[model samples]
Target: MKKQSTTAALPGKKTVTAIYIFVLAYTVVQLFWWGILLHQQSKEIAYYEQLELTHRVHLLREPSEFMREMQRHHHEQRMRTLKYIGEGTIFLIIILAGASIVYRAVWKQMRLQQQQQNFMMAVTHELKSPIAIAKLNLETLRKHKLDEEKEKKLLDATIRETNRLDQLCNNILLASQFEHQNSQPFFEPLDLSQALGNALQELRDRIQSHDILADIEPGIGMEADKFMITLMLNNLVENAVKYAPKGTKIEVSLKTEQNDLLMRVCDEGNGIPQEERSKIFMKFYRIGNENTRKSKGSGLGLYLTRKIVEQHGGTIAVRDNLPKGTCFEIKWQDYSLQPV
Candidate 1:
């Protein structure tokens, strides 16, 4: 029903925009047409006045007076014509400017609405897939007496699906909180190296298909919220995992250079297009069409990651990873490490 309503509204929006453009075009055409008519009318009036003056001068027998009157009339007519053109041009410029602004605003709103609709579709799939998998695994276990190893495998798969579902819920909730400014980071002394290491270890254990590599420098500390940092790390690594092909390398690195702290996650997979780099962090913005894309995500991971990074007074950006794939780089400049 929601999709149907959205589909129906799109045509209406397009129709409204079409009508608006048509009206604006008509108005502009009419404005120029009227200016032309007025110019011709002014010329006709001047011509008649000139003839009348010539007849009067002939009767009075004063050629000098006739020439002076003709000059004055011509000057006044020129000034009136210029004034009309100037006023019409100004009005046309104002109308065009207004139309451009309105068009841009409408386009932006439509794009946002489309993104939101894609997000809804993605979220529905994301929510249902894990629940279905977990349910199937449970049902399999309930129906048959499975061997120990088989049972363990089934249990692990179920656990992973549940974890995925839990993380999805967390992302949705955190995104909402951050958007509304209801959640703020609670900064305290934290073991940055240990936190990163632990997060990477968890990822390695849960995701067996990918090779997760950590090049973290030891004994680095900072003032940040531990929960938020862990969440951010999970989102970044998970994003790489989602996009990168199976068995590809995912490199997570953390180090300090002078007073600046840096973290990077580089993946060996198909890289993001340069055009999409700027928009990847926008909420509900994914790379491809939601219906056709094979990847599974709600488009909130990077958005939440950026928000968490900014909340901790840091910056994040994406760049091409050397030969192939993409790299997400984060930096905290002039960061002072707290004593562990």
Candidate 2:
């Protein structure tokens, strides 16, 4: 069903209204200026008439003459004022027309964004149930071994595919959450170091298989919502593992910088193209030209990380690391590191 909404005025409408009011008020100001000029001319004529030009008989004829001249000037000014008012109205109309175009465009963009978010959420929910069941079934199948080596290989492949599905589902969930303005993140303060440590422990198998190195600086602490922070690092670590060259090191650094807690994840992977850096934070945005996203991830990690940071009044960004790599820097304003 096509939803019909009696949508209230958005910021765009209010801005257009403001422009119209400003233009109309400017037209009134043009009339007002003419009136002021006419009055000033009358006053100047009165000063000159009784003193310098005429009426030694105390100004009867001179005042009438001055009034007539003032009337004539006022008539001329009225014509100019009317012309200005007409021009002002036309300009205002053009501005209003332009504003309406921009407003409609913006409104359409917002609606499309909302629709996409809904679609991602619905799809994620639809897939999650089956993916979980498949994972469970695969695990169950591992119990009965036909041939030891063959069973192990099949189990590993199944697990890999399951991880891929989970990653996709996670991306969808992140997109859905980001789309909601009133999303209340589940927040609980935790040690920043311990959280990273836990995440690394969980990815142990991937690390061992890929021989990925964790260049972690020891003993950093901070105040943060545990689950969100964990998710943040999980995305970064996963991104690093996915993109970094084989046998390359992923550096995870946690420290306090200028009264803000910072987590800098540097991967010796292909750096984001300079043009695409701004857009990589957008949902569903994938790096093009690289075409090397072989590992499974929903492509929403950085975007979710950004939303979570904003929720906690923090910031996250990506930049080129010196000597050919990408670095993700997360800064938390109200965070602190724990004692060594």
Candidate 3:
């Protein structure tokens, strides 16, 4: 499917934003202008009252009373001027603060919408490529008589493509379930060592190009949901595969420290930027422009991984994997076996 272009709307959005800013500026200017006019009018009224008082005092020949009335009139004018200035200042502050908040919210929403559009485009391409390859492979097998080796290769390729499609579908479904709070992990007694080893072995089998290494502690048992744990591990490894160069070392380590279970997935790839590390887990968020990015992904892996970890009472963090790479570290606190 051809991806829809959003470039055409860029200028329109910018124009709208410019207009909004212009209106806000104009309003602030008008508010200050009105305040100035009110201040001038107040002074004029005070001057006229003072002149009237003088005229009345002259007619009644009351010099001391005139002086006292003049003082009172001046004080009242000053108080009125201060009151107008104070009220105008308060209103101005409120208007600016409200405008700032609205602008940030609108900007954030627009960014999220753009990311979602990118995700849709990526998913379309991702879904099509695998399905097309698998169909073509099957058709080739049916239409021609091939040697045993050739047949095995085609079947293997078809299986890989089919698995990729299945995983994409699973990620989408699981993400939806977690988003709506409709899914809960069914906790049970799990052997952490065995599960981690199996997941790593499966990943190694699926991705033959990468050198996957594991350092799992033996007999580390924990109470957890096995399926969710496997899914989480797969996501972390898949993410490493997507970024890391072919044949580079991808290390998976699991160990226990002071009643806590720690799992780290380190990749020998270009590390994530410091500023973007925090945003990687947000749904539908990708590091670069989706249209131009060469990597194939639906941007749900990290998000789903984080959700699964959180669901199982664990914390996940990312850091620079020494020299040149990224490492995803996960910790489950106070790990212990529970009755099944």
Q: What is the C-alpha lDDT of each candidate?
A: 0.90, 0.66, 0.89
lDDT of 1: 0.90
Looking at model 1, residue 74 earns an lDDT score of 91
Off by over 4 Å in 3: 1-4, 59-61, 337-340
TM-score sort, best first: 3, 1, 2
lDDT of 2 by residue, 1-340 (tens): 1122213324655786688678667766765676567656755655664354334434546677776766665676566656656766776677667767876796667655654544454455446755776677576676665677766766676675576566556666666767876566765555567678777776665454334445455676545577677777777877788778877777777776667777788988778888888987776555531123344344577788788778778788888888989999977776555664
How much does candidate 1 score in TM-score?
Answer: 0.89
lDDT of residue 275 for candidate 2: 83
Residue 122 shift from truth in candidate 2, angstroms: 14
Q: Give the TM-score of each candidate.
A: 0.89, 0.59, 0.94
lDDT of 1 by residue, 1-340 (tens): 6557667877988898899889999999999998999899989988898888777876766778777888899998999899889999999999999999988998888888888888888899998998999999999999999999999999999998898888889999999998889997789989999999998898887999899999998888988899899989999998998899999999999988899999999999899998999999999999887756888888999999999999888999998998999999999999766556
Per-residue C-alpha lDDT of model 3 across residues 1-340, encoded as one tens digit per residue: 2334567658868997999899999999999999999999999999899888877886666677778888999999999999999999999999999999999998888888888888898899899999999999999999999999999999998998888898899899999998889987889878888999998887887899899999988888777899889989988999999899998999999887887889999999999998999899999988888767888899999999999999888999999999989999999988763322
Name the better of 1 and 2 by TM-score.
1
Q: How far is candidate 3 from the true structure (C-alpha RMSD, Å)?
A: 2.1
The runs of at least 3 residues in candidate 1 whose Cα sits more than 4 Å from the true structure, single-residue gaps closed, are: 1-20, 58-64, 145-152
The CA lDDT at 184 in model 2 is: 67
What is the Cα root-mean-square deviation between model 1 and the actual structure? 2.9
Clashing residue pairs in candidate 1 are none
